[model samples]
Target: MNQNETQWDKLLKIKTTGRDDSHSDQYRYPYEPTSYMVLERLANSGLIRKNNTLLDYGTGKGRVCFYLSYQTRCRAIGIEYDEAIYQKAIANKETAVAGNRSSFILCGAENYEVPVDVDRCYFFNPFSVEIFHTVLAKLYESYYEKPRELLLFFYYPSEDYISSLMTQEQLMFYDEIDTSDLFSGDDNRERIMIFKVI
Candidate 1:
C-alpha cells in the first residue's frame, strides 16, 4: 500500500468508544478493522459493486465510505448527525479525498435527501426506531418517484423492524452476512442485511 492507503488503514484500525446512553451527547463508535474487512468481503463478493453510488447514513467519521471509495473506486457520500462527529468526518473526508475518493454531509439522516440514483444505502445502527422509520418513509417516497434497484446494507440491523418495513414496502431480502467476530466479545455479533426493492 502507498502512504495514503497506509494512513487510511491506520484510521480504520482505531476504535473509538461509543456513548453509553442513546440520549447522551456522544458520537457513535468508529468501525473496527474487522468491520471494514466484512464490508470489503461483501464488495469483493459483488454485494457492493464498483462505480456504484453509496450513501452512509449516520456515518460517523466517514470510515465506511472512505474505505469503500478508496478500495473500490465507488462514489461515496456520508451523512453525520452529531456536529462534532460530523466535523471529524469532514476532516477524514479531506484526507481520504486527497485522492478525491469520497465526500460527506453534516446533517440528520432523516432530514437528508436521498440522491436520485443512489445504488446502495448503508446504516450502522444510526439512531432510534422512530428516526429509522422516518428515513425509510423518505426512501420509499424516493423509490416511488423514480424506480431503481436499491441495495440496502444495514449493519447491526434491527431485524424485526426491518422485516416489518420490508413487508409493508414489498422489498425483498437479498442476503444476511454474519459478522460476529468483527466485535471483540462473543456477544458482539454484527449482522449485515442486504435488501432490494421488489
Candidate 2:
C-alpha cells in the first residue's frame, strides 16, 4: 500500500487490496480498486456536493463511495455484481464514518434502477461496453422520468467506452481533471472525465 492507501485505510478503518481480478464469466470485469489519488482529484473538482447522491458502478469494496461520502459528505450508493465483493463492501461500509448515508447493492449494472434523485454516477471501467450501454439507457429513462441535472464521472476511460458514450446525445462533455502529475511513468492515463446531462 502507498501513502494514500494507508491513510485512507486508517481513515475508513478498513483494509482493502487493489488489482483484484475475477474469473467468473458472468462478471463483466474484475475487482480493481480505484486509486485514492484519482479520487482525491475528483473530490477537489467540486462536482459533488452534500446534497448530491452518487452511484458508483462496480464499486469494488465500496472505496469510491466511502471516500467520496467522507470527503464530500454526499450520499452514496454502490452497485457490485459480484457477491463476494459486495459482502466485502458491506463489511467496509459498516466501519466507515459515512456508513449511514452509504449503501452497497449486489446487482449488475444492467439491472440496477438508477434512482431518480441520483445526480452523479461514477464509472471506473468496471464492465463491458454492452453493459455500459444498458446502464446508460437506464440513466436516460430515469432522467426522463424525473428530469434533473446529472453528472457522470469516468476515470481512465477506455476507448470502447468513449466510443459508446459518444452515441449518447444527452451527455455533454463538462470538464476534466488531469492526473498526469500523480504517476511516475509517462503512461499515466489518469484523467477524470466529467459529463453533464440535464
Best by TM-score: 2
Candidate 2's TM-score: 0.95
**Model 2 clash tally, residue pairs:** 0
TM-score of 1: 0.78
Q: Write the per-residue lDDT of candidate 1 for residues 66-108, one digit (tens) a residue.
A: 7777667788888876677767666655555422656778787
> Against the true structure, what is each candidate's TM-score?
0.78, 0.95
| lDDT measured at residue 183 in model 1 versus the true structure, 0 to 100 | 52
Error of 1 at 49 (Å): 2.1
Stretches off by above 4 angstroms in model 2 are 24-27
Where does candidate 1 have its weakest 10-residue lDDT segment? 14-23
Local distance difference test, per candidate? 0.67, 0.87
lDDT of 1: 0.67
Clashing residue pairs in candidate 1 are 97-100
Q: Estimate candidate 2's alpha-carbon lDDT, on a 0 to 1 scale.
A: 0.87
Candidate 2, 16-134: lDDT as tens digits = 66766764454387788888898888998889989999999999899899889989999999998889888989998778777888998998899999989999999988888888889
